[model samples]
Target: MSELTLAIDQSTQGTKILLVRQDGTIAYKITKNHQQIINPQGWISHDLTEIAANLKFLIRKALSHAGDAAIKAVTISNQRETAAAWSRRTSAPLALAIVWQDNRTTKVTEQPNIKKREKIIKYKTGLPLSPYFTASKFNWLQTYEPAVQTALSTGDLCLGTIDSWLLYLLSEGTYKTEPSNACRTQLMNIETCEWDPELCEIFGINPKNLPTIVDSDSNFGTTTLFGTLEKPIPITSILGDSQSALLAENCLHPGEIKVTFGTGSSIMMNTGQKLLRTKNGLNTSVAWKRKGKTTYALEGNVNYSGALISWLKDRLKLINDPAETDEMAQAASKNDTTFLIPAFSGMAAPYNKPELKAALVGMTPLTGRNEIVCAALDAIIYQINDIISLMCQVFTDSKLTLHVDGGMIANQYLMQRLADIVQCKVLISPIQELSGVGTSLNGMNNQTLTLSVSKTYKPCLDKIQSQNQVKIWANNIKQLTK
Candidate 1:
């Protein structure tokens, strides 16, 4: 292996490629923004052409800074649930990539054919039945897109998540996805480590179109098409962005937990091997598979976080941008009873309701933008508490420190409230790019930098009052959605 290693993290928002020395030192890093769509029907999709176009420019710039560095391996970390299908002949995507946020699959997923399939699917994949998974999205593409239907009938279509598409482009023909990526499709059996025939029969997708499932640490192939580089490096590791972040955090032991606060907020706790089914909306999934043994996790996903702050800026015009919210937050306090439960795109995890609506409760005439802003921030943390309470049942000991990362973790008010409501130490990492850099690389394996606690917020609220207020907020949100 050469002293230099290249790692690319392709997420929902953008793609970042990093050049790291064998000493775990970052030589250089470059990122490129890809175009995303909130379509006419309000479905989120990624323009595959736009992403593909941006990659060339981004990679060229990243390598130019490498100078004479000898590259060893090229690993990938990607958004797990985003789906893309293409023709094997032209190797062009048939339609826009169905982003994980897209809700187009709700109709088909609830259909009789797919409805009964959820239980069976969960049994194998360790993922609940939802439009967020690839099974439903793949069905939607086939029914709506003529190009996809043609490819399916003629056997020209190849369906895969974002990682598969990237690996195909990088390898030129070697198309396979690691266990971390494959498990998200809701088609692969976690126990067998293979795509299930019965599961494919339920979704009406051909088994032939799916990518081959491999280990996370296994060598995928060579990046031959990346021609600007001096030598083609081996495609070494492919881990799901979330799982990779978990590994990068050095959460190799079971019972270790981390929360990622991004466009959405998710809390995942590492559970070694034992796949206990979640009863209170917590989803049990494969954290990562190594040496033929799979590590399981209890995941609690909350659909809205920073996006609420984004919504206030874009829809309400209360603030000019997301950055301005922090200043506004500083002026606001919890003295008012105002509560904003943002179920904008419905709620996930503990309150998995599709018809739920966003609400701003207990508002008075004296209410201002900053007050509303405070309530909104409080509501997001309250949601996290709801999931955390449910997550606590899995672990016998209630006393645990939460490791936090993501764009939203930067909000001081949100972090404080998160600690207060959960009654736990909320440790926020300085590097918000935990998802990108954490995936496929080790932060503690050979790295000198410590995953030290950047800031720790302790609980400072009355426990009873916080619990009562949270219940009231939940009830108010229930009414709004109804």
Candidate 2:
């Protein structure tokens, strides 16, 4: 019998468990939904209990499909930088699981305490001094959380990102987190690969309470309490979703870049051994670590991409299915030059303008639903193009091909438009959920997953046109801020 690898790709919305053979090919897949909590003024949180239940369900189903064989390993690629403060005594979250998109830390993000250490954090961590990361969320609780605040005064607070929370529960509170997951917390030192006590003290986070930083391929623990899988499954690898996808892309060498067009899009390029030491909003993320070495990357983010498509369906009443983006774009008048800035919870990455609201510009009296809807779709792809260009500029001017994946790539219009706007070669892989595919690759024995050319969207626009459009895009960004 072939050995199977059970891979879990958990996001804020739900948990997706897949059954993959030892050769890195997916055999079967199952996705289970998760619950989100919206507080008084729209603070988003995940019920870990609800998430755990969903996880157990998917894990069992995936295992059942895999049958009665000892699996290779159970790997996880989690939504990066989302935090939860839970109790060790009781396997319960003390507060809400502050989503990466949640802006509850808006006031505290500008606090003098966090401000004082912003530069130092950015310099060391390669991340912006923004509230989207775990540091600001942890700090926000110190001020905003009455119960958790007092609990911290004692010794009852165990704060960790989504990966850590899930690992703790899965391991039955035995295994900790890996270095790649830990580094995203902002509390960990990239150089030392450990939680910096000084940084922790500054942010009111205790380094001791944090998870241990292990190798990328290290065995974190075994699943005891999770699901109905009778066998004790070993939990081996853990990775931030984007980093895992980067690994999956096999962009091991420096100057290689890939863009994940998920809910909040990210464009990450491998920076290799030396840190780029960026002062801009570009993040210095720990790509992955193995054998006493680390792979570093510089990332530029577009926090609203595929999510905006969902908004078009549910909120704006544009299309019942997101597949209409292709049809709608084909249906739209090409002359319609409308634009949308989907800063629903503000922008991230190169422009972490959390306070900035969404915008729809250059609308004419003749602008109908088709043009308007098409514009929103184009604008989202345009924003991604803007960020990818910024990433190339910030990281390196190398001849880079963007490896594209996620649900949005199904929209050919956006992919073609992305190729045009960015003026680069965009390669879409046959596999869509590449983040989990990457994590499972670690467990594979042979058979490298080659980059199959599904379609190569080349630069269709001339340099002059692209530059002029980018100039106007920047102007719109500035004016909207003012």
Query: Local error of candidate 2 at 464, Å?
Result: 1.8
For candidate 2, the per-residue lDDT at 379 reads: 73
Off by over 4 Å in 1: 23-25, 397-399, 442-449
Candidate No. with top TM-score: 2
Model 2, C-alpha of 177: deviation from truth (Å): 2.0
In order of appearance, the predictions have TM-scores of 0.94, 0.95
TM-score of 1: 0.94
Model 1 over residues 308-331: C-alpha lDDT tens digits?
777788779998977776678778
Among all windows of ten consecutive residues in candidate 2, which has the lowest summed lDDT?
442-451
